[model samples]
Target: MRLEAVGRRYRARGPWVLRGIDLDVPEGALLRVEGGNGSGKSTLLRLLAGIDVPTTGRITGRPRTAYVPERFAATLPFDAAGYLVHMGRVHGLCGRQAAARTEEWLERFGITGFAGTALDRLSKGTAQKVAVAQALLAEPELLVLDEAWAGLDTAARALLDEAVTERVAAGGTAVYVDHDPRRLAEAVPRRHRVAAGRLTDGPGGADEMARVVIEAEGTGEPPAALPPHSWTAGPAAGAPGLLRIRVPADRADAALRALLDADPPWHIRAVRSTGGTSPSGAVR
Candidate 1:
């Protein structure tokens, strides 16, 4: 997929979220979008997914791309399996195939119990898993995810990483939006920052990237285990209640689990990265 000078504005009076953005994602490559909120990250994903039309420039790609937004789109009363079945049907999958895939993904994400639970009743992480499962069911040529890993636990996050890897290995492409550089460093090898209607490569010079983030679950403490290689610790921005532990790509999972299992309130939230090496002092 290739995007050139892509721009989008919902209203004439409002400022454009994306302006003059140019990007090229080769087949089977993982591309990550990074930026603060309202920085056009979601807008870009929407444009790429063809959910919203752009007011300026053009995007050239397959139209059947699978898009997973930051929020759940299914009705509140629907079960995870039901929602997946509906989505799969829309994507031309047979009833039996949809059911099989739904069951497989739900179990893989460690949410088998959620198969029958209403979307509204499921926890935030579980709902997110359903959303991801639906996207995967389509077997899209291009997978575009917006905050795809937000609110997920460590195990769920690992499942997502593996899913992306599998899809790419099948010659599919992915475009993800995230804010956690550490996760991106581990999952992706390339990074781009969105700002003022523009997109530019940021951090790491690689073509693929990976990143992850672990957050607190109300009253819980952050994880203590750090990623392998070089790691650094410091206060998280605008989050006095937590600390940011940056880890290298090699030991990210171990460091993350150790921290979460330390019996503190920490929970793995999201991961993003440029698939780069973490700084030294990452592990302790």
Candidate 2:
């Protein structure tokens, strides 16, 4: 999806909330939008989600979209499961499919016990879970989250993070706004900031940082001084004792040195860049 010189304002002559904006929402991409309060971040998200129309310019190639706004209506009449099923149907799922997805997301969000409870009867956090679940149930091509993590519990927040990653990995696009800078930090995602009704690239823009993935293993624990901004995870399925580390391209050498210098030393299996060929100094 793409936005070309998009602009928005409330009234015929009202001051613009966003203006002269151009953006590309590519498939399989994770994008973060940031800004101070009243800086029009939400407006841009709304436009991306097709919740609000642009007052000027054109937006093209929008796909099946879902949005979770900053606030959800907790007073809706339907029970949680019923509301989600209804939303799934609205997103074009069949009845049985909708019900199945409703159950799936309820369990994923750890809210299966609240399935039969009325929306208005749920607590704020549970209500937020419902809001998030509704959006995810559809597996939308475009997901727009406006502080969708605010009221979620820690577990739920983590689940949402995984869900967003899954969506992007599945060839969907996710555009979100969150107050936490550490959100999806491991992805090293593309970022943009809104200020004075305009959008600009943020720090760590996609082109500015390339990532390197290192696969290694050792009996001892990892080094205490791993490179900054790097993250480690357990190896892929069937690879016990293996560790996967991702670091910025520039720090790949430092991370490899740290792992190799550790007690008992880590054995390097592979090192490759996420965006192209193996980086320089990669070990096999």
Which candidate wins on lDDT? 2
Error of 2 at 111 (Å): 1.6
Tens digit of per-residue lDDT, candidate 2, span 183-209: 987766788999999999898676644
Model 2 pairs in collision: none
Cα lDDT computed for each candidate against the true fold: 0.68, 0.84
Q: For this target, which candidate reaches the highest TM-score against the unseen true structure?
A: 2
- Please list the residue runs of candidate 1 whose C-alpha ends up more than 4 Å from where it truly belongs after superposition: 74-77, 205-284
Stretches of candidate 2 exceeding 4 Å from the true structure: 209-284
In angstroms, how far off is 46's CA in candidate 2? 0.3
Per-residue accuracy of model 1 over 189-258 as CA lDDT, tens digit each: 4678888878888875342233333333323443434433222223312244444433334555666667
- C-alpha lDDT of residue 137 in model 1: 72
